[model samples]
Target: MKQIIKIIGNPKIFVYTLIWLMVLVVLGTLAQRDIGLYASQQKYFSANITWLGNIIPAPGGRITMVVILVNLTFMVLFKHNLWKIKKIGVLIMHIGGLLLLIGGGLTAIFSSEGNMVIEEGAQSNYVDDYHNMELAVINTSNEALDEYTVFDQPILGKGNILSHENLNFNIEIMSYLKNCEPLKRTAPAGIQYRGMLKNFMLSELKPEKENSRNRPGITYRITNSGSSIDGIYGIFFGQSVSQTAVINNQNYEFIIRKKRTYLPFAIELLDFKKVLHAGTGIAKSYSSEVNLIENGIPRRVLIEMNEPLRHKGYTFFQASFIEGLEGETTVLAAVKNYGRLFPYISSIIMSIGLLLHLLSSLPKLLRKIPGVSPS
Candidate 1:
């Protein structure tokens, strides 16, 4: 254990780790051109291990950071010299760095960001994820409100069996494609097939550079459904209609879509106004006047490119606009970050450390010059 501490807490290890982090940054940046920014981030930065061309595995951005964090932790916990009064400023600086690293980890794990697109005069309470997808099993039996049982991207792997106490049957995923399309079939399907698969077959497609453009699809088999409805099924993104089923006399709809996070408050687009630049059709500034409704109470606010609305930890910024036959649509970028204040706090701590360090060292240098007293 002592040997491990010595190796890990060494200044040499910290220097080498910084060099490795730089290498990963360069690798991730170069990969973005081929796989797009989001995909490259997921594969090379967010993940613990990155597979080179889906083969050779290497430590990723997250793992490299964890190593650096451990090194910092070991230096603080095992090194006794840092605890002395003379080294307080240096110790504080290290503490600030440790806090910054910890804050980054919190942000990576707990932050949620998505796009909320609302048409003029329309209200929405949900935001769609930019990259992740989910299989949503919704119980629409109640006319007032629907219940959602969502299976996220992680566990939707092919050959994986999914079951729930809330669900009457088991789902066995046959095929799960990152990007795909549904093609209508001329001939009828066999007795074992059901839902959209009865009318169309899913065709695999190449993923788009823009992560949001990719339409994912899934094919699965329903077992122990306790009805003639027990069979194979398929669903895809933006399908307009979900594959329906009757389980335990309750109506259910299964659909695959960009993961939806239902917000506590609803946003209604009251007005979408954009101003064009001089002598050009391009938009110079755009804004969305919205009503943020919470528990039946409405609060009006304007969200613009430079300005954003913050309420209950959620921040909404006017990201872009889309022109349609109906009118203009407002796309609001929604972000909820647990570590939003960390950078500010860390910077303050570092500044304080720097100031304290200067105060501690100034007198020592003054004694060496001319006739300053050593006492």
Candidate 2:
């Protein structure tokens, strides 16, 4: 245990770790050109271990940061004489750094980020994840409301069978594609697929590194009592209507789409305005006027670039706008980070500590100067 502690506290080890982190940063930046920002981040920073070009193994951002945190903690607790008055500022600075590490860990585990896209005059109470997808089965027997059950993407694939208590039939996955396009039906006669999919075929496309640009497609069969009921149903993102299946005389709808997170309150898009640069098509700025409706009351709010709206622990920033058939659609970048303010708070603490340390050493520094005498 003593040897382990000494090794962890060694200055050489700490320096090497920092150098490795810098190398990772350089590699990650270069990788973004080929894999894009989101993929590079997942591969280099978010992962626990990463292989350089699928060969050499290296510690990832999370692992490197964790080791640094341990080294800092060991130095502060056992190596430094923190109780001494002269060392108080050094102790505080270490504490601030520790807080930053804690905040990063919290963000990695708990933060949620998604997007809310609302057309003009439309309201939404949910945000859709950019990369993750869900398989949703909705009960549409009632004309008033629909009950939905969603399954995360991890459990879906070819040959996987999923059954739910509320569902009268079991869903068996036939085929899954990360990126695909709908094609005109060209299969031979006596084919079994039904509904709109019968007229359109699913054509596989090259998957994009940016997951949001990829259209995922799934072909599934519904089986009841060991008998195939719905031949084969194809569903994909952006499908106007979900494929419907009738089992045991009950109406059910199935769809695969970006996962959604429901918000406590709904936001209604009142208006969206975009200003263009003079004599050019480039956008100068864009903003959204929204009505935040909560508990039967509505509050008007404006969200603009660099200015975000915060309510109920969620922050919504005006990210972009799209032109749709209905009009302009506003896309709000929604982020729910519990440790969002930790970095700012830690930075303030670190700055104060650094100033105090400088002040404490000023007298000693001045006395060492030639012709300078202590007061």
RMSD in order of candidates:
2.7, 2.4
Taking the tens digit of each residue's C-alpha lDDT, what string does model 2 give over 56-113?
A: 8889999998999899888877774675789778888988998888899899879999
Winning model by TM-score: 2
Candidate 2 lDDT for residue 20: 92
Counted clashes in each candidate structure? 0, 0
* Model 1: worst 10 consecutive residues (lDDT sum): 366-375
For candidate 2, the per-residue lDDT at 90 reads: 82
Q: For residues 1-375, what per-residue lDDT tens digits would candidate 1 score against the true structure? A: 899889889978789889988888898899889889888888878999988778889889899899999999889888889999888888888889999999999899999999999999999999898878999898899999999888999999999999987788899999999899989888888888887788899999998877878889999999988877788999988898879998779999998888899988899999999999999999999999999999999999999999999988888888999999989999999998888988889889988988888899989988889988656
Top of the candidates by lDDT: 1
lDDT, residue 330, candidate 2: 98
Q: Residue 163 of model 2: what lDDT? A: 89
